[model samples]
Target: MSVFAGRFDGRVAVVTGGASGLGRETARRIAAEGGAAVLWDIDPDWLEEARKDVGAAHAIAFDVRDNAAVSSAAAETVARFGRIDILVNSAGITGATAPVQDFPVDSWLQVFAVNTHGLFYCCRAVIPQMIAQGYGRIVNVASVAGKEGNPNACAYSASKAAVIGFTKSLGKELATSGVIANAVTPATFESPILQQLPQSQVDYMRSKIPMGRLGDVRETAAMVCFMASEECSFTTAATFDTSGGRTTF
Candidate 1:
């Protein structure tokens, strides 16, 4: 919470799933700090409302699972803002909470489509832009469930684990480049995504946290904002933990 009041002055960011959850809050923080944010979301109405509330530079309605759409949005974002200094892949979904045997194949695919495939599409579309500028930040929003698999949430957990792996590989590939890539594993937070979970699941998550509660959006966003800034130059392909002491490793 220290004031980096103009930390992002003249910067541009592309935030996926920016209409709500941690994405929205991160967009707000960036815009408030003087960066131009291009908010992308699957919900047209929600995206528009976020643009208005955050005063984002652009509001894009698109599905990240669609490679073409992600590519087009990246192009449009660069055209409008000139450069994409930061990329935050915060969009994800928790598929039906059920055991692997009981989990619908369709639901599993859908979860991976958004959480894994969507992330790949967004990063693929923008990494070249970051490399061209000789400087950029990519923050992939993963979950602690990835590291410690949650029972009955096979799809969600596996997808996030893939995210972590992808980020690690990307970090190594970009090691010598100016662009840095990292992933954050946040424990259960009071975000819109929580609504998708049953009360039992939610409570079970909270119970594991050493802090005995969920993390706040601002706390998670603060870590993300830092990772997205010039201050994060030395770290890449790293996993940041915002898990309220639940993850000591």
Candidate 2:
């Protein structure tokens, strides 16, 4: 049982990339706390598995890169759950690990498509619902790479940096709307996204942490849950770090 039991008794949450990794864990936590979690992912099969594994209220399969699809998903969620109280943008991709000079153009664009543009689309679609309800919380899962750019990960780093900036602007815009927006920058951690990188790249990120260890997803989830709750009322347009002591700013 969650210590935050009943905190989200009547809330509804939409977590992108919810089939696995940070998104999946965050959804799990939200559901445990009594929130209705609506999971969105690109894979139908994985999404079903996650729905079962996380005990989500519902699941939708679609790429967040598609604005129409995101908008439709938002509508579908509200149709099923009545309101959207939380949205966690956690879908992302790390493009080819190569110096900027050698990076594949296609891979770079694809990274932005998923990591940056996709996040933007989801935010755009959900903001209207949140605004209509006069309440909502948005948590964009950025990365420490966004703060302290990692070598050979230009697309990923730059895109996440964009996420941080976007969240700041969003939070400020929604400050008085009773809708809150924030970004979380996590250091290297155990997640499916890690599998996309080379061991050397992973080691490089792990080495930058002063704590000498990667983060735990539950730790990130704890921070996310707080930010996605009414308890986070006072803060907006801020960046929360979970970099295991890697980022001081």
Highest TM-score scorer: 2
Measured against the true structure, the TM-scores of the candidates, in listed sequence, are 0.98, 0.99
With a 3 Å backbone cut-off (N, CA, C), the pairs that clash in candidate 2 are none
The C-alpha local distance difference test score for the whole of candidate 2 amounts to 0.94
Off by over 4 Å in 1: none
lDDT of each: 0.94, 0.94
lDDT of 2 by residue, 195-228 (tens): 8999999999888999998889999999999999
Residue-by-residue lDDT tens digits, candidate 1, 10-66: 999999999999999999999988899999999999999999998798989999999
What lDDT would candidate 1 get against the real structure?
A: 0.94
- Ten-residue region with minimum lDDT total, candidate 1: 1-10
